[model samples]
Target: MLMFATNDQLLKNAIDDLGKYVDLKDLGEPRYILGIQVNHDKKEQKIKREQKITLNQRKQIDDILKTFHMEDCKAVKTPMDVSQWKQSLARATESKQATNCPDVPYQSLMGHLMYLVQGTRPDIAFATNYRLWW
Candidate 1:
């Protein structure tokens, strides 16, 4: 369990209180949490109002792509219009067409991608949602 408090004394007190009931080992500041890289600047963090912390999941995204065998895929720089997506989905899921993937774990792939979308990649949320629904 990770807990933070503005006051150092209060946080130490809480930790001490919890330690009595549970075996607690302070891991000291976290470097990463849940595959997201935690970037902290102590100098910059001095000012509470202007302080900023960044969380990155590039490693997780790359691992996801490699796991799904999409490492060498080309990047789509152009922004696709919503209409184009609807048209694409319509053709892909036509009533007469029989689409089946017996070998590929498509649902599993979609589920993994969905996690990425929820974490830090909202850009692919629509695509993941469509795959999950359709």
Candidate 2:
């Protein structure tokens, strides 16, 4: 679960204090947890990096869905046109402008799609990353 604390000291103290109630001995300090990574660098302030997904990460998917905005979009068994979709770096490059062709909502949808790819949807990684190229 994502957690937010008022300050660094509070977070540190919490982690230290958690040792008393939760045994984290079985888990390693996560290098990458969920779509975010926890890193420590004395030289830099803490930053949350999105390990997967990129800008315009799923424009095609969202653009298509948006066209059906008023229509019902039930969760489907698949995320894309599985039978016809093919991964092509060249195609993605050529289609970059088209993918980035929309506005704020499309952009937001792209971000959400990227988060989805980072979370539990590994199957969409290729397509999502492909979208990133665009």
Give me the candidate number with maximum lDDT: 1
**Best model number under TM-score:** 1
Q: Per-residue lDDT tens digits of candidate 1, residues 85-129?
A: 888778777752325656677777887777777777778776667
lDDT of 2 at 98: 60
Instruction: Report the lDDT of model 1 for residue 99.
Output: 51
Provide TM-scores for the models: 0.74, 0.34
The 10-residue segment with the lowest total lDDT in model 2: 48-57
Off by over 4 Å in 2: 1-100
RMSD in order of candidates: 3.3, 14.4
Question: lDDT values of the candidates?
Answer: 0.75, 0.55
Q: What overall lDDT, based on C-alpha atoms, would model 1 receive against the true structure? A: 0.75
In the range 11-93, model 2's lDDT, one tens digit per residue, is 66877788788764534334455434455453344244312222332444565566647246776344556454564445556
- Clash number for each model: 0, 0
